[model samples]
Target: MTDEAALNALREAARLSPENLPLRRHLADQLLASGNLSQAETEYQAALGLSPGDHGIAIGLAEALVRQGKNEAALTALDPLLAMPEHPVRAGVLAAQAMLPVNRMAAAHWYRYSVARDPSQADPELAHRLGIGQPSAPPPSSTSPSPIPSGPAGLPAQPPSPAPAAPTQQPSPAPAQQPSLIPTAHSPSVVPAPHAQPQAAGGPYGSADVEPTAEVEHSPVTFADVAGMDTVKEALRMKLLLPTQQPELFAAYGKRAGGGVLLYGPPGAGKTHLARAAAGELGAAFVNVGLADILDMWTGSSERNLRATFAMARRNRPCVLFFDEVDALAARRSDMRQAHSRQIVNQFLAELDGVDEHANEGVLVLAATNAPWYIDAAFRRPGRFDQMVFVPPPDTVARAAMLSLMCRDKPQAKMDFDKVARATEGFVGADLKGLVDRAVEAKLHESIRAGRPIPLATGDLMTAAKTMRPTAVREWLGTARNYVLHANESGAWDELLPWLRDLR
Candidate 1:
């Protein structure tokens, strides 16, 4: 039989036997193959009603809705699946859910969970696509686990008594320490001893202690992939690249100079992307240490983590240490707050000021935060962030560039670039990309329903623009602008004040 005949047979069987969930599922598969996503979604939902525990049906239905440009609907469909108890791929479902909302923290948790559950899934590609990182190596296998040291005599470990099984599993035993294969400039003998002070009790500042074993994997991003932000790119090249390329000139300034750069702006303005691009351009190792990465559940781990992060950055010279959300980590602390938060903030302040002035260690620190005002005053002083740049919302020229890049491969009908740019006055880079994605999805869905080629018309784009409002609010922009104005008038930041005026 032809492919169409087989699909027709499946549909007829499903219609004749509505009670058979397998038949319904098969019908849904056939519909999907024929690009009839609406019908496929209906059939998948029917199958789900019959077999509520079927994760396959749930995923299929959610994906169908996603293809139909209904991401919210897809998220709703997955909510019940996420609440299920003890599924092997539950982590995968949770990750998908986080992606729908673009919640990076939640997504990172789910990605980690997914990898922990199935060690074989610890590939870097998925994490890179999600704008996170995966560990370079797969976690040790449970069947043939690595042996942990018991004592000085290397005693064999004892097995624990069995208990009632639970759905959520505890982490595996810590892997044994391996010998270092690479040589380092600093000798291990000269390294400072781990402090023996008693850690403070956990309080409102959360755990101040960060575990030495805790490490986050970040997928490296290259400069070629970043879409726009030419001005920001050029500024980073001048500030970071020029010094390294010409070290003799850099040395002339001596030890008292060379500080970090701060990129402050509204969220989704590509600050993180710019940091990654600079790292890639300069051939430097990219280390992303965010506030969430450092916050530990123990009393002194956060501070220790901060120290470890800086040490690692220094050791791995020609590196870029990116703090994506600095305000959360270095917030101005009130005297009444618990001691832990204040300690972490102070540790950050010290690290920011401790970069070697004359060594030209080739360590470039790039910190980004939407709420710059919330950061502690010490971190913003001249010696810490020598240069601060404001990354504003894209203007018409940049918006057009972003749209063109987003629609590069899509089959588009005649589009009015001017109208689209004008319509997206306050939209950030990410917002414009989302608009393009929505329009492409709508066009694909329509084409599938009509059994035609995927071709996006101007109307489809216009409809997408109407549905996606500017994510940034006018009130928020006004507040930020006012803060910039106040700072400029105060003359507190001589270098950044001029840029602030121009931005406004």
Candidate 2:
């Protein structure tokens, strides 16, 4: 039969037997081949519903979405498959293709990740566009296995028919022709292939590399979402928020909106939340970077990653690049034995100082660290992380507010939050969440025994609070007290004094 006739036959078969997963997939594949993208997408969705977690069905669906320019939707479809322990090759390649237009660096990583695991999955042309594969090299000869088709505008084309099997099924042994995503004994690494492509100019990785770490997000979580820390809010508004809002006003006083603000406090004091809120309050793009995003076992990769991250922020002007556990990436070089570790810190400093081709004109860098004492001192200079804000445990009023907020969505009685807050003195935001969880869990048990639903009363929460310890807050306060006493020469820890006094 002709191709079109074959497709029609499959379509009729699928319509007659909707529950036949393989038939549905085959029809979707034929529909995809015939350029009926919408029909292909629908058929693929039907196949996925019949057999969810079927990798082939998911990839076909994602490919159809991408072909229709719904890159985000394609990614959403592929995310579960990507999250598997052994990343599916087609899923990874399709994800990389979807991400390329918006985020080339991330695309490169995903492409490398897939091709490393299964070399036959490599799409040399797509890799070349992403600046990770060899562009100058010739295409595969007629004698070799046909190259995976790069669909219209490089949307991931369908791969050679893959058995609709579990992702754990290993591929035939193929040459290890691509870069390795395998990490070293020390930390995760992205070891480049012998013919690894070069990063574009305009600084390391360039403006083209829009997303180096996590995707840049437009945060809607304003300071209002934050439970308390009114003082921290105010400080952030003045130091970070106001300048962005009234740039011309700040400029009159020889001040600029973009600079670094370091937030240090006990764990679960909402430091990360506050940074996100600051970005939201300004209505800017927020990029949250962590240690895993920056560190690589290979030499110079960490610095390159850091530089790429800054390049990404610079591209997204009025961006808030918030780094959590900043101390890990910016640890005291004096204490570091490894040269690579020190190089990472130096790269961090250069990026903060805008010492490279890319300037941080409108990018406000905010970082949070529980152990502020461990960060390199050079980061404290006037232009770097100059504004060190100390976030303290929430006061009684704040605790009450947090309790009410936590209970807002839970099934609970009209309980007095203030009494509970007063009783739980040293509990931080995390502790309060734990308290609510405990109360809900206990209520669940009670409901099970009574054979009915039970709403949590104030007494239930009080009992839960009593069972938990505020050791984290106590330990953080103790550490702050020591730093204030002996290391207050520069008075960086002076703002922490009141909290220390309260702790005593």
Candidate 3:
């Protein structure tokens, strides 16, 4: 029979045999295959409600949630099944997959957990995606399996656990000494030593960052891929892209191909992504620097590490050194109590100053911080990060475009983009994403009740928007308004005043 005929027959069978669980599940599977997520979710929910303890049904429902991009919701659905010890490998695998984007290091731990339970269930792709693959050398044969050491969220910084003695065999003497000797750099000893002691800081891989790990990424995402922000794009074009495009024109005016830009905004305002886009548009290598990579407990290593990063960026030439959470590392030295913090700040300024104050010629130094007010003043000197770009929440145009971009892959119904945009005034790109996810959740419920596909509509989005608020913008503005009012000393916050005033 043709595909249409089969679907019709299944629907008829499901409707006629409302009591038949297999038919309902079959119908749900068919709907899922046809991209009818709303109805598929309904069928799965119904099947699950009928047979609450059925792991297969629960897995189906979780898979449906995942396919609809409700990963968190899928976790909620899988939680009950996870408690059962029967076939938790499936739940563990799915949870690990879901956690990858949110917390990659933690996901690696989960993958290890699942793999330990059943080595055959391991997924190399997941590890490869997270950049946490096995070392080239093979592991030494051991009769006993190692327990997966659990840690807190985000970065796993487990304190050294003494090896459990294997009753069946004598423990190797040498392997016991390895954990204490190694400073546990990349292995989640990420949280600094208590009281922030002066231990040797190293790269994420538990090795010195002096030579640094080879982690240069070529971003394919350009300014064109970024939604909205015409003003931001234009400023970047003039500051970086256009100069590179018309080198002679810039050279005639004694302008170099690169300089520095400080993207100061509320958190989740896409500062980091915009940095990537800038690198992509410039066709340069992107080297993302975080606090973990730079801060070492050892006194001079932090400075050395900081210099090495700049040196690497310079050698790469035409590289975008994007520093996330710049305020944390480059915070005002006076506010800092630790000598190391102050020294790191000094090193940061010196590196920005470079050899005889002209090192960062071809390198673009872009640092993003939610609290630009906390950034050191010396770093803002003309040749340094003079171009402070104020990235506010998405304006109307951006919100609309962001809505379209975020929901492009998902099966969306007739969504009024303009209406949604209007409803979400102060919402940033991430907030807009939340709005859509909330709407998807609401729509999923409605479909479950109606027992049919109900496309995501404007009303559903608007309803979700009414209950939601922009996360960082309101809070950031609350703090930023004070700076605008009191600390406009050098008029560094001059650009922020207009945007702040508009809110009032």
| C-alpha TM-scores of all predictions | 0.54, 0.59, 0.58
Candidate 2 lDDT over 339-377, as tens digits, reads: 456667888998898864338878889999999999989
Ranking by lDDT: 2, 3, 1
Query: Candidate 1's C-alpha lDDT?
Result: 0.63
Clashing pairs in 1: 208-300, 208-301, 208-302, 209-299, 209-300, 209-301, 209-302, 210-301, 210-302, 255-358
What shift in Å separates residue 200 of candidate 2 from its native position after superposition? 9.1
Q: Give me candidate 1's TM-score against the actual structure.
A: 0.54
Top TM-score model: 2
Tens-digit lDDT track of model 1 for 1-504: 998888888888877889987789888987877889999999998998999878788888877876787755665565444433233354353334435345444444445545555666664655675666553333443322333332212211222122333467644443322111011121111112132222323221223533433243343566566656677777787676877787778668753222588898777888888888788887777788755457643334567778778777776677788898887777786631334556678888888767455433567878998877777777778767767777767888878777776776778777676678888878887888899889888788888999988667667777889998888635446656666667656554453444345444
1 or 3, which is superior by lDDT?
3
Give the alpha-carbon lDDT of every model: 0.63, 0.75, 0.71
Q: How far is candidate 3 from the true structure (C-alpha RMSD, Å)?
A: 25.3
